[model samples]
Target: MMLLPEGSFDFALQDVLNRNDHFQSVTEGDACVGKVASLLLYVEPVMADSGCLQVLQRFVSDETLQAVAIVDDKHNAVGIIDRGKISDIFLRPFSRDLLGKKAISEIMDKQPIVVDIKTGIDDVARIIIDSGVRHMVNGFIIHDRGVYVGMATGLSLLKEITHRKQRELFIMAHYDLLTGLPNRLLFKDRLLQACQNAKRLGHLLALIFVDVDRFKAINDSMGHAFGDKLLQNIASRLAASVRQSDTVARLGGDEFVIVLQNVKSSQDVCGIVGDIAEQLRQPIPIYEREIHVTTSMGIALYQDYQDSAEELVRKADIAMYEVKQRGRNGYLLYAPDMEQQDDIRMSLETQLRMAIDGGELSLYYQPQVDLKQNCMIGVEALLRWNHPNLGSISPAVFIPIAEETGLIIPIGEWALKQAVQQHLEWIAQGLPPLRVAVNISAVQFQADGFADKVRRIVADSGIDPAYLELELTESGVMSRAELAIKTLTDLRALGVKLAIDDFGTGYSSLSYLRRFPIDRIKIDQSFVRDIHNTPANEAIVKAIIALGDSLGLEMLAEGVENQQELAWIMSHHCREAQGYHFAKALSPADLRSWYAQSIVIKCP
Candidate 1:
């Protein structure tokens, strides 16, 4: 047999055959090639009038000749006859004798299954199977550029199809479909290999677990498609931020794992982590909007932990969770003691869940006085929890846990209901009409139907909405500024007053402050605490006061513990004050008694 395109034929044929060796035979349901040009077998044909039987016998005798391509005078493929078709004719007793004298074209198939060279093997196989052709006497003809290139056997197309499927399966198992990064399985495998390398070299290796902060909130507010796009964008940024030697992988759902090999020192790890965090801090464009996201990272050192890859990953996860607990958008190095801290927090959370129903939670009220009148104008309600096992857990500790665990919604509601009931009791007892302010958490404030819930609670308590004031921290309001404004507007429509509780402590935009339907600004206790000693504190307080005054809003000072701070507050014409200088937060009954005592002293 002669190969086509003469000199180039053998090398190309050998290469195709070598690559095809790795492919298994095509099984049922496999994708097969419609036409394979590389497997084409071109055979010289015998003349029709010249003793075709002798030529056919010679073709059958040749071991490599499976089929013979019969061409017209112009060398174009006109018909084909294979060993199987010739065997069928000779098997019949009288058939070969009667037709032996006829031309070879008369015995050859007039029309065979002709297909394009580029068509898929599965389609070719289906067409052949559907045609009820029990055996392929003449294999399919392959054409490229509308010219006959060669013919392809059923077996060759099947082998190539199986090979492609195996390659696809391998890729799907190792890589994340959306981000094209290594999945957890691949990451863990690489991490194990990296750990071995680090141990042998006596070097440090760092594994970082990253979680995108507030991702669920963004996903819920926007559609999941948008969330997916956001994650993809974040994946690209994370990949670009790390060293090429490091492996960045997606650990599913807004979480990523990075393995840094051959680390020299902790400082090197810190620099890399900082760069990754800074990269994520930039705004990402998605769906015609710029969505900003921050990442919380936890780093575990292989040299320090000396654990298995799975254990190291678990430690890194714990550290990342710690950063989230510490208010997110930060990183923490793993320490063994953090495990104990986690256990303690878990215990406290369990106890706090039962605190409310167990009758261990109560409110303490601190009076806010009008300095000019020397009388209490309002009271701020604070929560206190006395645990059965642990006595008197501080609000600073438990409040945050409640917020994190979503127990704040119920706890905050309880506080609001209790405060309103107490104030109503005082009013019924013939006390002066005084407002009661309650601090609101960001989670509770942004919860669905929060404003409606507040309205219902105030209505059920039968207290005038004017006497109920809700305090929101600057950070809480500004986190979702537009939503805060809408919620605040709804609450104000119910006649309840709103105040920025810890003013000047967050990135509060002045534009948003002016737009919010706020009634007052309470200078944060941090600023008011050191006003007498710290010049910067005094300046900040004065500026806040002046800003509040210019906006025609009232200013209240908190944590004023002495006459010096009180005098400074009043000298600056501040409207209200709340601190231990006048009185500490007391129980409802003690507050009533303190209110009854008229203590008026002139400031010298």
Candidate 2:
């Protein structure tokens, strides 16, 4: 084998002109090469009858020509001669002298890689790769309708493939596939640019964060295809609601963002938001049904906030969460107080992560008394957190945060296990076994394998499952009614009692309520709070108790604080009650002592 000379081929002006013309005629701007014709090089072909020395002379004259096609008298491609083979034949001692007068056909490769001009680049590439690396070095002959035209190099093929991959990566990185909108990465870049422009021009810029309200519920109910179509439709509306100079981007899943440039004032921002709300709220036809949609919008103005791009985005997100907290389907401007509140919540979230392992969490028992018998019948286990630095925190303050961050799943499980162990401990203390109610968070109740987890806890604790009552909120069970029914049925099979806590507070369907395998309903504290004075409160309480009676479910009133409230509940024939009227939630030892002294009738 002989190595061909490096840089032996000349890159002439004629060849450059030919390449430019071929590119302009056959290829579009920056797109992947579509056909072999797109990469054609105007390397002239040699006649088969030409002298071998003539071919050797032609090769020596141009170093850039890697291969030359051998054509018949009719100008159809017949064969090929690569530089290396021709050079090898002549480099031998006195070989050129002997073969110089011989016909070029004597040395031309009969089996060359030949392809049609219309052949796809990818197919040509595969053929070249499958044949051998020598074909790439020698190049392939391309013809249009069996007539020799030009050739294509492996280098050009590789370049086009690389460009295609890069284009694909760019789209994946900067755009959402589902909505064809700019994604988070592109959104951040545009936001930074907008902030710089606003600062330099002394103009206002607003960053708006938009989140679809209860999108998960809708998605779960209507299927993911419907959800994806909904998001795409929302994206179009959002883009249309803003200026072309501004940007609309999807930050993933039901959350989108907009960058508004050259804002006149907060009033202008308000008007734009109002229009967006109106457009988004219009009913979307999905699955042959019209579905109403709503979004929560939070806006942060650059001039008003005077912060970095990241801080502006953070402020907008905080304001959006505020809208969700108050109730969705509205927008709000970022206020300084909201920042303080967000900061406190962030700090608390950090602390709560460590609270479980740091021994900062404990259960306080609240006694439930049977008003008819005037005796302690059961107790609800309440989770209490005492921060090492901040002292005791109310469940109302931390429970929602827990649910949002998904910490409630583990926390709720721990609470259930602790309640079960406490019941066992009380039995060991020579006290009669009483039903222990554990409040379950909605996040925990809807979690996968929740019934299995409860079964394991009860089985491992060596306690009777009937004495372990799991209290679920009406909203928790009603959110996913079918799943809730299945889970409740499984737990009931385990022989554990179930109750709907804060019963009247949530939107529970009467149909769903009748289907749920619950043993009791705890009247929410709100209705029981002012039952003695407020007629509306009294009416709600009466209605809940009557509903419970009609369903053959035991009713327990919460927050029975005074004698008048207790009198009203007792006269209404509600059998059970629990609140400050008896005693506040007490520690293990305190509750044990309080129960012994407070019991009017002792259990057998």
Candidate 3:
């Protein structure tokens, strides 16, 4: 193929559509044998006698002599022609005689000093001047491998070259400068393109959406210079993981996208996903720490032919959420069932926000009894939501939702204040002051101004700080030990008690107990509920009680139902207890009334 090298400067359109240095195929010679198709006013040959002189009246009137160039089957530009030449020789003088006597090929110049397909306008001008040809025939031909494919008048080719150059500039404007990867704008374009490709392939294509986990934290701690370097490193690694046929893009920030093409089956995807997960699992060292933050990848697979780009991205996002739900550090494949769950969760989240705002929620205290006395000494503040229509909602379900949506911070605050208020009221009425142990979620503790909020609530409720206890799960504190201690220490300084709720069930290290200011440990209900039958439960309960004693932390046996379990707990010096073995979570008024008349209820 030969390119009109110097003439390329003539039009941006050529630059826009054509970039390869390839030109129309041509042999040696500054002069090429221009073809009749481009030079002659040639239409689809009418298949009449060769003597018919065909004319294009429309082109003849519009274009100039400079606009015409022609090439042969070998891509050789045999000669050049222009519109004016066609009109002069055939249409103006001897018009009728020429029309009947000869075809365009017969009259058109057989050889003129011509422009090679590769000849620049600078050189071609030299040829026209050298040949002293008065006029050029119709237009220029652009050929691929010696074949006649297109005609480009010098003017049209010049215009095309100009237009194409401008479009290239447009691409440079929008595309990412580094890695030559698409920035957000181009990524969206490619995402759309990928969706179309997936539809055409009759196979699946999955978008593996990845956000380098905690990339900002690393970026913040390590400095921006290092962050940029790390990003480059990551981009390289990620790009290497996919096929040459696929696209790996940085969607700005730490987020990236992988466009998987021509996927054979879901397992092929699963294997790739697992490999990616493992590759990311390896710690990326920055500075001193072998900082390992695993990805939460969401795959939006092409499951149906009807899906669009927006739907695919949304599905991938939804799948990423499921990975987060499964406790992060992994991936979730997009599924139809997950969409249903997504809808339900969104609905529940909406209703839950309303529940907090409209004051449709409250704390229900369940009495914690002394296993030996069979009498209540303290109560765990079990949160209950009277949903007005849905009735009382369980903690098991919404506690998680609250934690996720951050609604637990406010709801928990309300519960703490209400519980304290009720406990204070019991004391003022000459009833025994029950220690109010309110369950504290990780979200509540990690909240901004948590210590301040708790202090204010205790003060406002007029409850003795000593009679208040904050109960956190052992697992929760263990996960964020430093932050938990800072939060826990501030609360403990206010003179309220603190306990690890649901202990021995979570895999809490022994070291966790020494890290924070905890006053008590409550054996999880699972152990107590089955202590009679499972020797493992009995042994675990005893060891926990013993460990609590050794640590100088008070012990409570939760779910000490029936006489055998009660007997076992009391015998082990388990001092505080609560479960269905006592009363289920109840309103403060009900508990007060029950305490006023109830006998020494023995476990049966």
The backbone clash count of each candidate, in order, is 5, 7, 47
Task: Specify the poorest-scoring 10-residue window by lDDT in model 1.
Answer: 20-29
Question: In terms of TM-score, how similar is model 1 to the real structure?
Answer: 0.82
Q: Write the per-residue lDDT of candidate 3 for residues 457-528, one digit (tens) a residue.
A: 877776789999999887567655666788888988999999998898676777867777889998888888
- Candidate 2 clashes between residue pairs 3 or more apart in a chain or in different chains: 8-63, 9-62, 9-63, 9-64, 10-62, 10-63, 10-64
RMSD in angstroms, candidate 3? 13.9
lDDT, residue 19, candidate 1? 43
Ranking by lDDT: 2, 1, 3
- Cα lDDT of all candidates, in order? 0.81, 0.85, 0.68
Q: What overall lDDT, based on C-alpha atoms, would model 1 receive against the true structure?
A: 0.81
Task: Name the candidate, 1 or 3, with the larger TM-score value.
Answer: 1
Candidate 1 residue runs with Cα over 4 Å from true position:
1-143, 149-174, 598-604
What does candidate 2's lDDT look like per residue over 144-214, in tens digits? 89898998776676565556445555676788878878899999999999988999999999989999976
TM-score of each: 0.82, 0.69, 0.62
Q: What local lDDT score does residue 156 receive in model 1, on the 0 to 100 scale? A: 58
TM-score-wise, the better of 2 and 3 is 2
Candidate 1 lDDT tens digits, 1-604: 3334533423432333344322233223434322354455545554434355765677778976667666666445666677777777877898767877777788876666666767755566556665534324356776666556677664555455556556545556777877878898889899999998888888899999999987766776577999999999999998988778899999899899999999889888989899989999888999887867888999999995469999999899889878877888899999998898778888899988989799999999999988887778899999999887889889978887888788998999999999999998998887777889999998888787999999899778888999999999997888778888899999999999999998898879889888999998999889988688899999999999989987889889999999999998999999799999988999999988887774843222
